[model samples]
Structure formats: structure tokens, C-alpha cells
Target: MTLTSIPIALTIAGSDSGGGAGIQADLRTFAFHRVHGASAITCVTAQNTLGVSRVDALPSAAVAAQIQAVVQDIGVQAAKTGMLLNQEIIATVSEQVAACKIVNLVVDPVMVSRTGAQLIDDSAIAVLRSHLIPQAAILTPNRYEAQLLSGLEILTLEDMQAASEKIFELGAKSVLVKGGGMSGELRGVDVWFDGNACETLTTQVVNTPHTHGTGCTLSAAIAANLALGKDLRSAVHLAKSYVTTALKYSLAIGKGQGPVGHFFPLLLSDS
Candidate 1:
């Protein structure tokens, strides 16, 4: 029997039909971390490990109503947002989050795909910065998302530090600028910056083709850890470690940027 309590965490985001990212990744991460996971999908994407081909957003009111339904009935200790496609959806989510007073919000600014597809529009970025950033407990942005939000090119560690500062200035309680995309020679670098201090998280980057859901998985793991009562910094640290392990154990599953093994530990134990 498991000795852990199942803390509840919610994912307010899009649905990835491929099961590699978006709401799919959130649920798997929650299960992996022993959280009772709940989700309200805001958008649906026809995506695969290969790439995103089509997107159909849910009505903003429906999205808002689903969030209300989940929070009112089941409740969540922590929540994370991924793939919030449009401004209306962003507003709807922010309104509900405010009304429910649900703290511990982790926002993954998923703007572009690794394969060069634009996952989010420029307008959504403005809405995210103006609305969601202030409400979020943590903001997770990759190099490109960081540049778009902070108006700084995150080429070096110094630029990353400045990006974190600008992100916090936009109102996030804490920021995680994922340096997974930093230029040549730096394979592994992710940074965490709280309002008070910053820490650089490094690992031997897994040179694998299967990294499709890294951002979603990392943010969800952090939310799961937070739901389990870990402090923000502790949550981020553990989440980063978890993502690294997941990537290390990844299976090359698709034609393009494939999925890491979200259930690696479970598979290992079953073996």
C-alpha cells in the first residue's frame, strides 16, 4: 500500500490528443507524483509528437464554467495552467481563479513549439502578462517565451537573470526561466528566481529526440509537489529533478520531437 496522501491539483489548459502534453501530461504527472489530479480543458489541439496541426478553442464561458464546477465540487490544493490559447480564455480563467481564491498557480507560457509552430498568438502574450502573471504562484517560460515577455534576449546567464527580474516585475511571485534552449555548449541549464534570490539548476542534458512535453511536465510536477505540501523552491527543485529523470528514461515514440516517459518509475517498478 502507498504511504502517501493524494493531494489534489487541477490543470486548466488545453487537451493534447497525443497524450504527450497539455492536459494529458498534467494528469500523468499528477499520477506519477501521487496527486489526485483534476482538469478543465480550455482548448483542444490536433497535435502529435510530430507537431501541432490544428487547434479548436472551447468557448470561454464553457471553460470558465468547467473551472467553477471543479473548484466548487472537488476543490484543488494547487493548480497549473498550460496552453491557454486566447485572451477570452485567459480572462475567464483569471476571473475564476480570483473568485475561488485558489493559490499556488503555476503558469506554463507555452507559446511556440519545438518544431517551429506558433502555439499561441501575440495577443495572448499581452493578456497573459497583464492578467495571468499577477495571479500565478509560479511562471515557467522557455527562452523564447521569456524573450517575448521580458523584451530581452536570453542568450547568456546574465540575460536570463534580467528576464526573471522583468517577469517578476510583471507580477509573478516567482519565475522559472527554463534555459533548456540556451545557445551552443550549454545542454542543461534551468534557473529559478524567487522574489528574494535565484538559483541555477543544471543537469547533464539528455540528448534524446523525445522531449515533446518537457514544459508541461515540469510545471505540472511543480504543481503536484506543491499540492503535496512542498514549499515553492522545494517544489521547483524536485520538479526539475523529476523532469530530468523522465527525459533520461524517454522512449523515442514519434516521427518528430517525441515524448519522454512520464511513467518511467511506474514501469520500472512493474518490471
Candidate 2:
């Protein structure tokens, strides 16, 4: 019998004990796309649907070791970073990414929440902008994050386009300004900008409160598609479609908010 080799994707993120976001969601997204998933957890969070209670970041050396272990042996076709908790970790991860030469990188700048709240400190954000983001093949930032990065207000599609361009100037090959944090008709309308072209991507809004891991899932889906040999634009579109379908069947578990159903096809079959 011959064994077939599968495309592999790596998720360098934090761990969510609630099983809604971070490494958990990324791994699930990778599996759904039939890509072998590797992970290097950056931090451990004690949280559930309601909120995050505690977060303990791992040592920089430990995170580097994990990356080395995976890249040296198992290998990865694409990689992503979620929450690099602090400056030290972010800088370390950035260095490791450069050292490992992981080119197909998707960076979900998890610096702000969908509600416009900042997640990391100024120093960490600075280091992430200076180091890691420039190496990204695709930089995915939510509305608030886009605003912070571009120093502009994102209230319309045009604003999103402009923001994408500004972020693209930061050295990322491409930029995606996510609209999950937008309001009215602008919501769910993402803007994509490469060096040459800028476009808006609209998908059917899956009205659900259980959107805990949508950001992580979308980025992971992008990485999975890249691992499967899709171009950047096609990868983003397919990933958006996958997230939309998953959102349609989003799980309604836990108290505050659950998660998007990464395995929505199984839910359909079970129903």
C-alpha cells in the first residue's frame, strides 16, 4: 500500500481552552480543508464563551523550539500567527519565521477586538508592525486593527479600500481589511489590496451571535488553501465562502457566544 502525502499548514498562535478560537480553531479549519495541521502555541488562555479570564504566555525560547521542531521535521507549506501576546514573543516569532523561511504566511493582526477594543500594548504592536507584518504574504486585520494600522476611520467600502492600500504600503504582499467589525451594509464586506489592485469582497452575512472564532478560522482557511496551491486572491475568496457556510451553521453552545461550525458539513449530515 502507498501512502499519500497531504498538504501541511502551521498555526503559531495561542491556545483557547474554550475550544472556540486560537490554535483550536486554526487546527480544526486546517483539518476541514484536508490539510495536516501543525501548531506552536504562544500563550495559554483560561476563557470560555463569556470572556477571557487569564492569559499566560509561554517562554520565547519554548515557542522558538516548537517552531524549529515542526519546520525541521514535519515541515509546513504555509503558516499563520494569531496572538503573540507580547513584544518578546512577537519579535521571537518574527525572527523564527525569517529564519525558517516560511514564505506563505498569513498574519491575523489580532491587536484589537471586533468591538474596537485594543488587545496588545503599544510596544508589542510596534514590533509586530515593524517585523512580522512585512514578511506576511497576506495580512488580515479587523476593522479596528485596520483603523489603528492605517490611522484612518473605516466607515464605508471606500474607506476599507483606502485602508487596505495604506496597510499594503507596510510591506505585506497583500492586505485584507475584514469587515466583521463594521456596521450596517458595510458589515461582512472585506477589502483586499495587493500592490496593484484593490477590491471589495462581499459575502452573505450569517446572522449569528456565535462568532467567537471567525477571524482565526478565516485566516486558517486562507493558509489551508495556500497550502493546497491556490493563489492569494482565489484563496481569500474560497476562505470567505467557507467561513460563510460555517457561519450559517454556527454552533450555539456555551453562555455568551459559541463558535462558527468548522465542521458544518457534519452538522448538515447529522441533521
Candidate 3:
């Protein structure tokens, strides 16, 4: 197959030593979808299923160099950003992405952890809003992140709709406000908006504590689908399905919140 015929997706994010999230999860998701995955790691985390012990961020120039290297040679059909850490890295990544002119950009604004704790400060959020979000073809932010970006508290589906609109107003071509962390019926329901249409994407709630890396996995799957030539709406639908199915096969490893099974299909076939 020629180079153009092969799907390629890039992830600009952090590295999780635990192998459950960040670049690890993103690459795994890309591979499962048969897309060639490349990465520019912004930070290295000493983390596990239990919690993060430490994070060491790379210099802004280093991060930009990685992106430049990948885009100059291998090329990226679609790309996603996760765990950008701080203002300098986010700004640098945003600048590099624009310089590369990557159209299918999925911005997973990873500001909050799965445990509902804030992972980034207000300054980083501001930098993301000003630099990165406007360039996104799709912005995937979880409930707390949506709340932070939109300045609207999300408690109901109506609130999610409001948050989606609010985030869309920030200039993303589209926005997906994830409600997986919400309470009651709102759980597992994601809100999508493109300034013209508003849609709700949902899946059956897989009740398990082993949901580490879900947000990363979902956005990466969406980027992979985009690399495969799917439209934004269809990509979100397929990515949602993939994440839900993976959650059903979530691993219970390391005594805490394990990762969604990215290779669940292969495991099922082997079984």
C-alpha cells in the first residue's frame, strides 16, 4: 500500500508509566483501529492505577521539536492532544499544530483526573482556551472540564447542552461535553454540538471502577476514525461505541482504577 493509503494518526500528550493512559492509551487505541500512531510526549508521569506519584514536564522546545519531527517526515492525518500540563507546553503545541496545519485535530482538554481532582491550574486553562481550542476540529472535555471551560455548572442534560454550546462558542469547530462522570441518568451520555446541530451520544453505563484512561481512549479513537476518513459525527459515534465496549472488558489490575481494555476484541477472539 502507498503512504497515502495507510491511515496515520498522531497524539501530542504526556506519558503514563502505568501504560493505561496518555500516550500509551492513545497509541493502543490507534493500533486497535489499524491506524499508524505517532506521539510527542509533553510530560512523563510516574503514575499507576492507584494515583499519580510525580510528573516531569519536558521543555517547550523539546515538545515542539517532536511534533516538527513527526509532521515533517511520517506526516499526520489526524491528531489529538492530552495532558498538556501547563501554559508553555499548550501554547507551543498549539503553535506547532497550526504550523503543521493539521485539520483533523481532536483536543481532549485533560484538565481533570478521573477522580474529579483538578490536574491543571486556571492559567493553563486560559492558555488552552486562547491558543488550542480554536484550532480544534473537535474538543472533547469531560464534565468537570466542560464546567471549567464553559463557566457553567453541569447538573442536568440541559446543563450539558449549555456547556457544549458555551465551549463551541470558544471557537472549536465542534465540541463534545462528556457526561460519563455525571450522576444519575446523565452518566454515560455525551453532548455534541457543532454550532448548527446539537446531538446527544450515549452508551450503556458499564458500572466498574476500572475506568482509567477513558477520556484519553475516547478522543484517540475519534482521531483514529478521522484518520480513516470518517466524518466528525460518525467518528464520535464509532469512538463512543469503541470506548463503551472497551469499558465492558475493563481490566482490574494494580489494585485501583485500571484501564479500559483497548484490545478487547482481540482478547475475545482468542478466548
Candidate 4:
């Protein structure tokens, strides 16, 4: 069927009251790509650039209702999920994705914090692996998260490839093991693996401390590109480039680590 307006992308995630990450970052990235953005917020966090002060998770029913509301009327072309805080939320999300038949799904396994802390318990990780991840078109996990999901410590490029392969075996169509948290030379490199081939995707690394929501932005950009009709590899490639450029213009808001400038081009022109 032929369409008229811009493509739509949906993000099921927690709400970052700070507006640096979570649903806030996802929507901004969608807008940057000219995609209509919708969201189903699973949890609410009282956070800022400094840190998360508190968290309040929505009921599983409420989260599912939001997804139903969006898919029933708005209809997403591609969707992504981040920060499903627990097993109930994970199961609810998986049910909705299947009911809606959401094929272009990006799963950012937000099980570990950027600071290398585990955010979810072992039970939640197990639930995510068994329920939510198998529905994903692409699974995007940072090094620490990759270790948890794939049961392997990812310290080298070879380890990243092996983890990607292991995660791919869990039924995701593809897997991307993000190496941003790796130290030394391995940092900022990512390994992408589908069932057939493994590829390394690299971009000019932007040296900046103001990177609060890099992963969310990258995955959201990939979903937007998917909605815009890009193939999976091209979508990931373009998303990485977008994140790199955004990092070059990362914002210096609040007192701690700030957010990447989602509208860097516009902000630069306005300046």
C-alpha cells in the first residue's frame, strides 16, 4: 500500500525524567530522522545527569495498555524497547509485540548501566532471554550486557564476535555487541553478527564525557532508519554515523554527564 506522511517508530521503555535517556532520547532520535515517534513508558525514574535518585515502575497491565493504545490506532512501522525493568514488564511487552506482529523490533537489553553496574537481577535477565529477546529483529547490547546475556566476558574483539554469535543463537535475527565500555584499543568498536556472517562496524570515535544516552540514541536511530526502508546493515551503519555526529556535539547540561545533541545540525545552525 502507498502512504503519504512520514514513517512511524515506537519505543517501549522507561521514562527518563532527566530527558537524557530512555523514552526521551528515543523520541528525540526519531524526530531527528523525521519519523513519528510513539512510546509506552514502563517505568519512571527520578534522575538527572548526576544519577538516578529513585525509580517507580508502572504495572504490567498499564504498560501493555499503552502499547495497545499506540498499535491499535497509530500503527508503527518499526519499534524498539529499552529498560523493561522486570520480568512482568518483559512478558507483557513480548505479548504485545506478538499480538501487534511487530517485525522490525530492536531490543536494547538495558540490563546493565553505563557505569558497569547490573541494573536487573538474574531472574529478570532470564525472563528477557526466554521471552522478549527471541522476538527481536535486532538485539543491541553493550559489553557488560553482552556478557550477561551470552554468558561470556567480552574483553577482546574475538570475544565480542563470539558473544554476538552466542546471542544470535538465542533467536534474535541479528546481534550487535557494543564495545563502548571496553578499555584501551577495543573501546568504541562494535561487532555485528547475523547467522551467516560477522562484521565489524566502526566510526570515528568522538572523545566526549557528555555521553549520557548514547546507546538509546543509536538504537532509536536504527529503528527510524528501518521505518524509512533501510536494510538492517545499512540501518545499523547509518545509526552509528548519526550517533558519532551527535557525540561531536554532545550537550553540557546539568552538572554531570550530559546528553548527545539529537538536533546537532539544527543547534549548530541556530548558534
In TM-score terms, which candidate is top? 2
The TM-score of candidate 2 is: 0.98
Question: lDDT per model, in order?
Answer: 0.87, 0.95, 0.93, 0.93
Instruction: Give the backbone clash total of model 3.
Output: 0
Model 2: worst 10 consecutive residues (lDDT sum) = 1-10
> Tell me, what's the RMSD of every candidate?
2.0, 0.9, 1.3, 1.9
Pairs of residues at least 3 apart in sequence or in different chains that clash in candidate 1: none
- Give stretches of model 1 more than 4 Å off: 1-5, 115-118
Q: Which candidate comes out best when scored by lDDT?
A: 2
Clashes of each: 0, 0, 0, 0
Q: How much is 256 displaced in model 2, in angstroms? A: 0.9
> For residues 1-271, what per-residue lDDT tens digits would candidate 1 score against the true structure?
9655558999998999888888998999999998999999998989887777998999998998888888898788999999888888988888899999888999998876543356677787778888888999999988888888888877788888888888889888999998877766544587788888988888777888788789899999999999999999999989999999999888777677778799998778988
List model 4 lDDT by residue over 126-232, tens digit each.
88998889999899999999998888988889999999999998999999999889888877899999899899988887899999999999999999999999999
Cα deviation of 187, candidate 3, in Å: 0.7
Cα lDDT, model 2, residue 246: 92
Q: What are the runs in model 3 whose C-alpha is more than 4 Å off?
A: 1-4
lDDT-best of 2 and 4 = 2
Tally clashes: model 1.
0
By TM-score, how accurate is candidate 1? Answer: 0.94
TM-score of each: 0.94, 0.98, 0.97, 0.97
Give model 1 RMSD, 1 decimal.
Answer: 2.0
